[model samples]
Each structure stands twice: as C-alpha cells, then as structure tokens.
Target: MFLGTGGMTPGHQLAERDDRKTAWAWYRGRAVRDLANGYTMKRVYR
Candidate 1:
C-alpha cells in the first residue's frame, strides 16, 4: 500500500508569474511509479 507522506504543495502563483513544479522521486530505465495525490513522478531511461 502507498503511504500518505505530507510534503510540499504543488502550486503556481499567478500574482508572482511563477510556473513551478516538483516531484517526489524519479527512476531510470524503468516504469515510473505512482505517488500520492498531487505528487508528480518522472522517469528517464538512458
């Protein structure tokens, strides 16, 4: 089962014209795993 680990919030500030993103973790040469809601996941195979 996945755990609910509280973390930073993923947000974009319109007033400050900020477009930012964050991820929990990443893996290479493999499928990306799903994280808790609002969490981003990425994988790169080199």
Candidate 2:
C-alpha cells in the first residue's frame, strides 16, 4: 500500500513479502534512513 502526503507528492510505501521483510521511509524521491522526529508507524497483524 502507498500513502501520499500531497496531491502529487511521494509518500511512504508498505509491501509484504515472504522473503523480504522491513519497513522503509522515503522523501522526495529517495529512500531515507529514518523519518523525522515525532513520526511513528505501527505494524498491524493479519
């Protein structure tokens, strides 16, 4: 799933795979090491 901030701005992306598992944040058009302070994310189990 993809979450956009602005009308046409890039935002966070989440994907699930059996072989790969990790959370990532993106800014502008590049992958970031970490998000800014006060930002947080929670994982939901299905």
Q: Any idea how many clashes model 2 has? A: 0
Best by lDDT: 2
**Cα lDDT, all candidates:** 0.29, 0.34
Q: Model 1 residue 33 lDDT?
A: 35
The TM-score values for the models, in the order shown, are: 0.12, 0.12
- Least accurate 10 contiguous residues by lDDT in model 2: 10-19
| lDDT of candidate 2 at residue 28, scale 0 to 100 | 29
Tens-digit per-residue lDDT, 1-46, candidate 2: 4345554333232234421343222242243324422144423321
lDDT of 2 at 27: 43
Please write out the lDDT profile of model 1 over residues 1-46, one tens digit for every residue: 2233434222223322342222222232123333422244233322
lDDT for model 1 comes to 0.29
Clash count for each candidate, listed in order shown: 0, 0
Task: TM-score for candidate 2, please give it.
Answer: 0.12
Q: In model 2, which runs have C-alpha deviations exceeding 4 angstroms?
A: 1-11, 14-20, 23-46
